[model samples]
Target: SADYQKILKDGGFVISMSGKGNCYDNAMVETVFKTLKAEIIWRTIFLSRLEAEIAIGRYIDGFYNPVRRHSALGYRSPCDFEAAA
Candidate 1:
């Protein structure tokens, strides 16, 4: 628990997996994964796992990180949010 305490003291943010008893804790993350699965992974049949990897990599590096507007970040793309900071 020392590392957890140190992280808390340093104001470091960490994501934790939901405990089996705590459904609410993973709700948002689960929702996002549901969206990802529904919209991207489940929608198409790829020739191989490598193709899926490339598609997701490109989605994150080329589109999602730099261009997609996130409502939680005041509707700014992650790159825009970091640039302002």
Candidate 2:
């Protein structure tokens, strides 16, 4: 929409949209969401919105970024990959 484009432009942000039916355009993000759903969201029950937010934050910061191995990074965690780079 023109409004959305205007908002993005006004905010000094670049907008990139995938074409309709283009699964490969956002494959990495889709994979991450799928993994998060399977590994964390599906396994835990949250009592409140805050609890869920904290849990997801911990999962990404404490485990995923620092400890979890990723196949794309030669089985290294993101932190390790960054360190090597």
Candidate 3:
């Protein structure tokens, strides 16, 4: 919607380069979702939305950001890559 576009623009966030349903602009995000599902989501059953949120937060903060290595980051975790930069 135009209002959403305006909100994003006002926040200095760029909208997708392509139209909806086009995955080219968000391939990396899609990959992350896939991995998140495979690694944390599919294996766990959450009793509530808050539980899921907490689990995801821990997965990203305690492990993914600080420990999981990525090939794009030369096999270093995001925290390590950012520090090296």
Candidate 4:
């Protein structure tokens, strides 16, 4: 299909594993998803989809991007790591 072919071409320079069922292949990403679900989704029951969207947006952009410390990035937030670089 054109979509599949185009995706392959577009991702020529990217390092991504093809297919699924390989948990160890994307460990860091899986960990982040798990943490988000545990901290945000499981902790609160949103009355509306829009409310949940807004809350997640704020959590990631306002809190996670600037203040959340990541072990992979030398215990610094993504914003701090980027600023240092």
Candidate 5:
């Protein structure tokens, strides 16, 4: 934990806490960012900002929502999870 804090400090990332009662503030947003960096940003080299934007849009519409496997949903995509429900 100390090493993580040191890395954040070196990176100039200021860690902030949620309000006292709102326990889930930014949790989902952080998870999405982590997944996006791992699955797309780290793997791709785009020629332009517009190209990267389009690719991210496509990834969200074409894969992440309807097709990407969610382990918490028994490894099913959102579409399949909804269908089963």
Candidate 6:
């Protein structure tokens, strides 16, 4: 624990932690990973790491962030929500 704290302090990184035994703090990230796996990862077989990287980058940039609607953001895509903000 001290090592982790020291490393964060040295790196000037802010640590965000959930309360002990509370999983809700990471729910949003977990949901995104689950969606990615279901929608993109599970559907394709990558021939190379580079291809996978590019495909994933395209999926996130061309589709997910700009096109996919998120119910948590009142059914708006992230780009829409950000522009509105």
Clashes of each: 0, 0, 0, 0, 0, 0
**Could you say which candidate leads in TM-score?**
3
lDDT over C-alpha atoms for residue 65 of model 2: 90
Lowest-scoring 10 consecutive residues by lDDT in candidate 6?
A: 15-24
TM-score of 3: 0.86
Q: How many Å off is the CA of 78 in candidate 6? A: 0.3
Question: What lDDT does each candidate get?
Answer: 0.80, 0.95, 0.93, 0.88, 0.90, 0.95
Runs in model 4 deviating more than 4 A are: 8-15
Candidate 4: the clashing residue pairs are: none
lDDT tens string, model 3, 1-85? 8998899999999776788788877988998899899999999999999999999999999999999999989999999999999
Candidate 3 lDDT:
0.93
Q: Which of candidates 3 and 4 reaches a greater lDDT? A: 3
Alpha-carbon shift of residue 52 in model 5 (angstroms): 0.4
TM-score of 6: 0.81
What is the Cα-based lDDT of residue 31 in candidate 1? 68
lDDT of 1 by residue, 1-85 (tens): 7788678768965645555789788776776677667867888788999999998888778877798887878999889999999
Q: How do the predictions measure up, each by TM-score?
A: 0.64, 0.84, 0.86, 0.81, 0.63, 0.81
What RMSD value applies to candidate 6?
2.2
lDDT of 2 by residue, 1-85 (tens): 9998999999999899978999998998998899899999999999999999999999999998999999999999999999999
- For residue 68, model 4's alpha carbon misses the true position, in angstroms, by 0.9
Q: TM-score for model 4?
A: 0.81
